[model samples]
Target: KYVPIENAKYTLTERFVDEEGNEISPSVVKGTDYEEGSEYDVTGDAKVIDGYYLKETSNTTGKFGKGDMTATFTYAKLGKIIPVDPEGNPIPDAPTPQYPNNPTDPGKTTPDQPVPEIPGYRPEVPSVTPTDPGKDTPVKYVPIENAKYTLTERFVDEEGNEISPSVVKGTDYEEGSEYDVTGDAKVIDGYYLKETSNTTGKFGKGDMTATFTYAKLGKIIPVDPEGNPIPDAPTPQYPNDPTDPGKTTPDQPVPEIPGYRPEVPSVTPTDPGKDTPVKYVPIENAKYTLTE
Candidate 1:
């Protein structure tokens, strides 16, 4: 008394397209009632979607007699370029750029990127064009306008040679700009200062010296004709090695004035403002020979 056995109606669609199909999410049908030939299957769920990147997928395993079946999942869009530093602040390693998803026109404009040299920085724009293929595209950078240096006040002489002539002081000074050069130091006759290089520095990027380093000034006084200083006279015999020109004060021996006759039999040591005099005079001719 039994006679029928019918049941066949399976459908399954999942589509999330956008390579050109343009639908980007929302489409998930399913209907079931299969038994015609008895064999069926369906599975699809690529979904993560933000900047998109799943490329392609269409035949998601099926056999419900082939009546309605879709699966589709194709997406592509993601192009970043960020490199800021004018206040936007993001130039740490600074070399980023990746783009390759413009199926027809994600807004269209991508093929230029090559602006990464940053050694003192200065790049408002030299390359980078990606107009929104999925966001993130900065590129700002700016900090290189310093090129006028020239602050050289050097007068060196501890051995670096060049004892004078090198002034220039300020020709314009840039790059952080704040030089002092210690008031441009220069009285240098017998030399003194002994140590300094870049004196007070702040300006950079080329041309800037500052070095003062002198050293060569000793004493050896015994002056009296009128120049004064002859009270004790021996305390001033220095120059052990101030750059040894035979060490200076070894011949300073004129200190005996009982009847007075010293016009300069021994004091000769120049340089420290030139002072070489050991004068005494008052012995006018007196010869009395008497042999016992």
Candidate 2:
């Protein structure tokens, strides 16, 4: 008497290999197997087969009744093929596989390798190099085409000594953008600020430079009773004076004039210079006695 065993069921899965030979799990079920023999035959199919070729067909188990079988069908992708120019020749380099011998098989090859760089010819697709086959792989060769410029500030004290901690060391600006420089120079005691150069207009293609200069305050001079500055005066002593060079001699009282009595007793001068003449109105208007 011969006993018939129940037919075992086998599952076939399809995987794709990309141009770089990276393995990619595709959502495809080739078929199911229900054969009664120890050794079973299996076949697979793909809805889309563009840029791909059947590389291998294998199974986890050769005997059907031993265990559940997984038949894996791997497809290798053709190299991305593109032309260097409109004429369609001289293709760019193909994606290099991370593992030479056992390249991970991704599902499909790149659409086309970027065209080799040629004078006056630009590729429609940007050139990108595939990283090692894995989740969240970083992309290579990002392009930067925007123009950039730099703004620099220089500060100096009245003695030409560089001030500590520059106001604005350097700043970056896009081309054609404006940079404000009105407040670049800082105020210092006993010194006046003078801006020599600044970036007020739209930024240009090249780097920008700003400059500032400071001047010391001028000395204050004192005037004497004669309205003339004391000659050969020394620098004024700070916060003190009995003989402070900035001090002036006390004014002498004006002598009494007989014909014209002065209306004011004395005049004081704040600044050193020639004395200002005093104007006096006649005390009494003369009628010449009208008789003579």
Candidate 3:
């Protein structure tokens, strides 16, 4: 009884094996079968080997159902991985993959191929290059020729203290690219970003430094006649004249303490170009002398 199996199909599996013949889990193609002239697409599933890159090999595509055919892809080992911070600062502790899996061979050392995912950091694709052919003995793998940029966010208080290690906002521009400074600044707690430099201009050009200036909340300190801070002084308020609908009146009477009279009956607050103005109030009391 020599009856051929109807539509009998042979299994076509693509196995991605490392240099040591160990199969990479991600590289393994799901088991599929095809009859003669039946189409089998591995285009989407084919992945570049890790720690190695695709080379200019002769074989890329072919017909299916050639009797359990095996397609082997060639890859070059990676030599280096140069990781940089968002500000283009080099991260020295970045992982480096070994060449020929050897530690002693300096010529074979290359940067790791995988870009590390650090929270609040944006990583760029790494540049790759083959080992120098001029070396005493040519290496088998390619190395990271240029370091990739990983942008990190920055945040600080008015006093230059670190408030947050990163910014929640994102910028689309790359290093050396012109950035617009006209956009509104990100809001921070208890502080306002001062426009010390050009607020509406291109960055990386003349007087176009992207500098952020944070100003703390305004304060009015009441001092004694001896120029010492007074205890329990009334806090000054800005735009204090609530009666005026326009809120243009900046004069607000100094708060009355049981024993003190203001040197001036009313103090006018000064506008420091902030959302709110600060007013300094000096009070004179016959019971206790107060100074500015």
Per-model tally of clashing residue pairs: 0, 12, 13
Instruction: Please tell me which model should have the higher TM-score, number 1 or number 3.
Output: 3
Candidates arranged by lDDT, highest first = 1, 2, 3
Please give the lDDT score for candidate 2. 0.45
- Residue 84 of model 1: what lDDT? 77
Predictions in order: lDDT: 0.63, 0.45, 0.43
- Residue 271 deviation, candidate 3, in Å? 7.5
lDDT, candidate 3, at 124: 56
Over 4 Å off in model 2, which ranges?
1-144, 157-165, 225-292
Candidate 1 per-residue C-alpha lDDT over 1-292 given as tens digits, one digit per residue, 9 for 90 to 100? 9654456465667788888998988977744554445454443356656566566677656555535566677777766777677798887655666654434433343467666665446778888766555566888887667656577677878788988888787777777888776756666655566567777968644456788777766654555567676665453434443443223444656666544566767765655434455666555674545789
Worst 10 residues of 3 by lDDT: 133-142
TM-score of 2: 0.28
List the candidates ranked by TM-score, beginning with the highest. 3, 2, 1
Question: Could you say which candidate leads in TM-score?
Answer: 3
Can you tell me which runs of candidate 3 are displaced by over 4 Å? 1-155, 159-179, 183-192, 195-211, 235-249, 269-292
In candidate 2 the C-alpha lDDT for residue 128 amounts to: 39
TM-score of each: 0.25, 0.28, 0.33
